[model samples]
Target chain A: MANDSDGIDIDYVANLARIALTDQEKERFSGQLGDVLKYIEKLNTVDVSGVEPTAHAFPLENVWREDAAEPGFPVETALKNAPAVRRNMIAVPKVVE
Target chain B: MSDPLYYRTASALSRELEAKKISSLELVRAVIERTRAVDGTVGAFISFDEDDALARARASDARREGGEALGPLDGIPVGIKDILAVEGQPLTCASRMLGDFVSPYDATAIGKLKAAGAIPWGRLNMDEFAMGSSTENSSVKTTANPWNTDCIPGGSSGGSAACVAAGEAPLTLGSDTGGSIRQPAALCGVVGMKPTYGLVSRYGLVAFASSLDQVGPFAHTVEDAAILLQAVAGYDRRDSTSYKTDIPDYRAALQENRGPWKLGIPSEYFGEGLDPEVEKAVRAAIDFYRKEGCEIVEVSLPHTEYAVGVYYIIATAEASSNLARYDGIRYTHRSSEATDAIDLYFRSRAEGFGEEVKRRVILGTYVLSSGYYDAYYLKAQKVRTLIRGDFLKAYNQVDALLTPTTPAPAFRKGEKTDDPLRMYLSDIYTIGANLAGIPGISIPCGFSGDGLPIGLQILGRPYQEADLFAIARRFEEAHDYHAKHPGL
Candidate 1:
């Protein structure tokens, strides 16, 4: 796990996460990528025989609450903390031109 | 002001509330004052609603005056983890994404707590979307350990653990994706229980990793946690993953006397990477348990080594999918200068999510995407089965598995921040239980040389929290670990 093969594109990850990482951060994180990948590789050795793969720790079951309508928070109070709003609705800057 | 009640367990507080010795308002006030004083240093709370809490406490007092019987936790102030939704409150998982997202409804756990007369004090801090092991990942602020201000409070439930340790709240609600609850609890010297996966409902918890996430309680004592769990655990129709099984009275289960019990020490847990001080503290705990009439045996969890690897793949995959909802349209933050709605989705998500979250999202997308799905995601699931099998195999021969909760005591805030892999390794001793969906608890064993707390984790079979609590309680009763405070 070194900078020997195709390096993990730190810039691509930074773009995905939207943070402007300093050059040092990119270099440091890039160098450490191999260790992360290598550690995950170690998990391949476990022998899973006759064991059912569990997506959830509990047996797959539906937890349903009553369908009856309950009183909800008033819209005025609910929207009180909105950082940005317009005409009783949470407003965000116009995304589509 | 009879006795000025300091360090009262949730159970004891409930008993006092029923006995009419302490008014709910007084308790609420005391907790608010304590939180105000220490929260500045601990950074436990992102938001503390003192006025609302007092209002609720006064109402509870009115109920008592009107001869209306209150619930078990009637008027006990509980710090809610920011990840759980509280109706009409901001449900920020310590991230900029949901900085303004208000929950229209209460989470099932919060509803249950309210029904039990537990006053919601405030939203505690946590890792952004419960991603990292330390509270440093929290976009809001880092939660400092009460024991030492410089050291980190283990996270993504770091604030919850810190609040309990600092005596700001007698009990706090936290969610465990991996060791989010147990690890922080250990580091902060408090009792944290990750109930059997389905024991608590996930109806209103903001999803981090859906498959692995479960809400649990953090408290100063095991009985306090048990009492809180009794009120919160049960089937919820809203949460499809919630169990339909009967909700047993966990408090009663704890009261059942215990004698000799089978305890398994997984060899892999005691191997290299464990700090010498943590090892000594855990060994002393095991010895104490043995003296309390428990049979200790060496057990092998052959797949234990693969736990962290399997957990990362599965948790990241789920996180990637679950977090897809944050594309800026229906809820929370949207970027200002997007050229179109599609750009809004992409730009908002890219800007709103923190670095760690984006890293995970990308990793998850890579694993679950078209070509690599079978190779990474499916393979990880197969290994997850083996990890569960290992637990089942060991449980067949022993009653419970005991191990150190963390590799070391609370580390300094910036110690592993630069090294992501080293930080991930901290969860090595804890991720297996989440993978296997078994119940585990972290109880304070002793302190390190520098006086930071050390925790011993006890893992039990699915739905065997009763046995785990019994063993943990017995150990607590015999040893004085719970009695020692951080001198905050």
Candidate 2:
């Protein structure tokens, strides 16, 4: 959980993002993102006291649709882009090995 | 040089088609020939099928011959930004991850375009996952500004704008999430409109920032933009966010709603970093409105400086979440160098994404991570509320705000490539509208001394695109800026 002086822990963040980065990327991004973070620090000047956070421009709630069964993309069509397919399902590397 | 059929506006082409003076087949061929001729230098399209486009044009001609034309857009070919799902066509988003991916079904917008008999043309390039301002982030190829081949077409919708400006297509569609559509449209000197959030369905658009992302049109004229907007705009049950509102006749609104309307000039937009030429052109546009009997007022949107910071946090945070669907197991790129399931995810993404994408994903993950969530993410949302409030407060005094679409015209390629922060500032003016969920349009106003195009932006109240179009049309008709095409 320890972070660099820029307040960003690139290794930890990249790991959490589940993307492996080369050593060069880690260095380059750390410097670039550090500069960006420094610029973003300007947000601290704005007083947001008691201000409500807006998650959406116009937040919609309880958008209910008909709960009826309808045809979707056929399994073959859905699996058309899979790297590997077996028995009509996407095949993946072993998870529990 | 005389204007070719390829450079005609969609509205003009529609009139000629109705008069039977031209066939959709002939028009499509001209566009295909134009694309083949200039695309070598412009690099506007990632891929296009001449045979498929020709066939669709023939179908439109057949429908017209039988006295059953769909609409004004019927028989016109519209270039599609590669991010949208065009069923059975490539949907790359200009990224390596989906390099081989073909859409299984049409996006709601694409379906609507097809229903209008508008042929879905080529796959236009964009910033990989619509993450960058310049199309340079595109893994495919950089789309050059058609005006000057060395300058970058402002993007992630650069290809969409460049195609129309280069006369390759009369109309095209681009999604604006923090100025993706407007900036490029401004840089490329075409009419690019980002409708009120949820005004157009996002069912098929690849999400970057869900709240900020809205699909819009890039066209040669304000009226052409209106025509394209009319075809694909409306509520879709599939996209819960698609607002249910009265869809007006935007083209008719151009002539009908001619105004002696009130306009505002936000003081913050005219400050430093704005190029002199861009300022001069936009100021001239404002003076035109004043001369036309419209009351002009100086307004303040105090949170203008904070827009870019707020956008990067919110947009990248959303992008990080949305792009999680691109795991190696499914349709996206798979890594052969994986030892296990977890290894596959890491290696595939690391290899597939470009530098900017990785940077944003990392920044997003950090801000949303456990300890920093409230500090960065929540605080940004609150600031976002303030930004939205600033625009609404101004709207009470003015009908709409007029400003420079971009701080400057298109810059030479590689100028800002090394500096990501500098690149983000290029979207400074257009981001406010998206954050506020309001409608905004960028129309060709004038050109820089270097001959690059500059744009004038007009922002309107939510769902009031008629007024927005009318305001822009006033200036468009006053001058022949929209009539000027890139010398490509």
Candidate 3:
């Protein structure tokens, strides 16, 4: 598992997170990453027999509520906190080039 | 009158309010004054509206005068964690990115609080997006533990916990993604409950990791916590994930009809990483419970040690997807000098989020990404099943599981800030409850030699919060853990 690095570059992680890390922070995090990975690897040793995987920590069955639409916050009031809005919708920089 | 009104529990203040001994407006004024006095020292609040709180308090008093029925939490001033949206209030998750962002609407929990006549005192500080275990990760400022000014209050809900611990507010609402509520409650020496997931509505709570996040209350006493839970819990149509079940009267459950409960003592919870001092205090608390006729049985939750690994993978993977909305365009912070729109999305988020937040986002992305999905995220979910089964197997023999809320009591500020993995391990014992979607509460059990608080966590079966509260109340009655307050 230690050698199964599919180009998991530290820079790639930093870039994805959008944080510019110092060389030292990167080195330190890399070592910490190894420790975390090693710890998680221990989970591979557990045996499961006839275990039904659960998504939530509680037993939740069909959670359908009445479909009646209730009064909601006015759109104008909702958009009041938006940093960028245009024509009643939240505006963002156009993603596609 | 010299005593701080903010420190008084909701249960205590409600009786006064009901009897008209102290008007709700007077309580609001007292809280506002106290908040102003200590906010600078503790960094408990982000935004406070004294006028608004007073207005609500006046209305509450008017209702009382008119002989109108009041809710369980009527006239109580409560702190809302920054992550929970309160209508027209700045809902910054203590992050720079959302500094200017105000909520257009209230979160379901806040809405419930308002309906019950609880006044919104203000927004409290938190780990940005509820990320860190220390409130230090808040982009704005650090919230000091009221117990010791130099020490951390414990995080994500640090500000909420500190306010309640320090008497800023008797009751505050905090969300637990992974021990955010319980760990902080333990560190600050207060009662915090993470109800069975889906028990509380999550609508309008800015999602961190949808599956793991559940809003709960932090209060001065177990009864107050139960009452607050009663106010905010139940099925909500607005939140699809909310459980569709009748809300039980938690206050009634705490009235003590049941007794001599069976408590499970899992050995893994007491092993290696536990501090000797914490173990000693917790052991004493257990002995007190045993004297109260509660049977303590040693049990094994074999998958318990694997909780931390499974939690990070599942929580981070969900976080990565949930936080994708913050691309610098729609919400709070936007970056300049975007060569184009795509660059704006990348650069804005890059600049807006902090180091720990970024690390988790990256780790989340990697786990959820194509190549590693099966090995990491999928495997974690499967392991999550095993973890839940372990709890179920133990519950079949015992009523509730007892463990130390945190491996150790609160540490000094910046003690483990540099070491991320070590910091993550702090939530080890508490994380499994969240992953398994069960209810857990952290109540002050005892104090360490240096006088820091020690917390005992009580974990119960799904939707069995009433039983959990019953056991906790028995323990509280036997030992005066709730009576010990910080010197602040």
Candidate 4:
């Protein structure tokens, strides 16, 4: 219905994911992702209407630990690989003027 | 001393090291030298810090000298897949995105391994973010199949298997989401085992797919895999998904007699796209179990056909969320082409990821988008439950399920690179084990006409890894397949 790109638009999805694709990638991905989507259409045929979704293979209650803070990784170790570090803290581009 | 130390199993090396016939330093040096000599063509390693490895080895030797030995894995050289963090070492995940990202701490599995005195040797290669069936998707290196240089070693644990097969490392850890471990082990002609989903900790291991992703071992023999699994399998609070259950010594479990238990041969796995030779080999393995007094039953995992589809949707969806950490502000590759934060995210990711990764991320975003989330993601998850139910029902009759690890042996490099769908289908048989949270081991079953190896996958019920090890050991001890290493 509405200029079908296999039921979902690719360009908008890529934008949401924050990935910049070239014009060629956009076309290739549109066709390729369309094919994958079509293949997955086979799932609609299966009678899973009543079945519950299993987000994890093994479902367990969230584990909690003791309330004492152990000597964790040092600040230097944390900032060791920062692409932009100033004053032992990660420096990011300023958001507001 | 006749065979190189790198070729020897960690179990054997352990015995030798304990008996003082060889020191850890000597063993480490021998393996390092072997890796240096052969890794030029195998491309199994992305980084091998000789000084760091030696320092670890020397420390292990000092402990041993002081009569403070750890355990069976003491001083054994083990390769870590780059996805598993090693403190002070670059956690590349074989992607340019994290090329400069140094881990602040070791993975839970790595910590267990270090406590057991394993020398974490090098960062092995994998598919970028463990997305592809072949290591050709590696953003950093192209690891060749050690058996035949032209063909691919299966992936995304290709380098872990290849390095072991090439005698570059005795044992290595790999992560299997669909079939990254077992498939590569099959293609590279070795033993690889994926524990039940929560059997090992995932903390500090870069996430690909949270539910299906599991850390496992690649080894030359079942016993070696069991030993390595023993060291890493346990409860860790850091990984909430890790099962807090009694840990069994997998090596001790290997000695258990594989009895009159029924073995299931799933009819679906041997269906249409199955290779004749691989089917023959796997069927012969089934018959071999029968001859060894195990009952053979023709069981059905009816939803096996939908495993690949379900796996792609779920794995990519999880990956889309997991990989959102790599923005320009963090400890990874930054794009100099960006003028703003939003542009920074776009440019950094586009430049950082490889073709396959970008494709999956886009596909994932599409499925989880507004109108399609229920149609795709939720539908796939429900199908996943049906798939899991199939295994649970089949386990009602059989103790374990048998199938070919892959449809065919290793294909020549560049053969299936173009078609993403065709490549995804290579994981057909092995994907079901992961979806069900069942333990699966792929051992060297036979050789193809091309001299490539075939693997027989044995899938066991969840938390029955010890029994799986016992069954695998039974087959391994009876056959000479594990003894036949690839001639590199």
Interface RMSD of each: 4.2, 2.3, 2.7, 2.2
Clashes of 4: 0
Give one digit per residue, the lDDT tens place, for model 3 in A1-97.
Answer: 2235334577876666555567776776677666677777776776644656667765556765577888876888767767778899987666565
Judged by lDDT against the true structure, how good is candidate 2? 0.92
Candidate 1 chain A, run of 10 with poorest lDDT: A1-10
DockQ of 1: 0.35
Question: How do the residues B1-488 of candidate 2 rate in per-residue lDDT, one tens digit apiece?
Answer: 25799999899899999989999999999999999999999999999988889999999999999999999988999999999999889899999999999999898999999999999999998999998888999999999999999999999999999999999999999999999999999999999999999989999898888989999999999999999999999999899888998899888888789888999999999999999999999999999999999999999999999999999889889988988888888899999999999999999999888889989988888889898888788989999999999999999999999999999899989999999999999999999999999999999999989999999999999899999999999899889988997777
Question: Which of the predicted structures, 2 or 3, would earn the higher DockQ when compared with the native?
Answer: 2
Could you report the Cα RMSD, in angstroms, for every candidate shown? Answer: 3.1, 1.4, 2.4, 1.6
Please state the CAPRI-style docking class of candidate 4: medium
The most accurate candidate by DockQ is 2
Checking candidate 2 for backbone clashes, the offending pairs are none
lDDT of 4 at B424: 92
- After TM-score superposition, the amount by which residue A24's alpha carbon in candidate 2 deviates from its true location, in angstroms, is 0.6
Better of 3 and 4 by lDDT: 4
What would the per-residue lDDT of candidate 3 be over residues B375-487, giving only the tens digit for each residue?
A: 87877888899888889999999999888999998899999888888999999988999898999999998888888888999999989999988888887877777776777
Clashing pairs in 1: A63-B237, A63-B240, A64-B237, A64-B238, A65-B237, A65-B238, A96-B340
Best candidate (score: lDDT) = 2
Candidate 1: residue B438 Cα off by (Å) = 0.2
After superposition, the stretches of candidate 4 with alpha carbons farther than 4 Å from their true spots are A1-7, A66-68
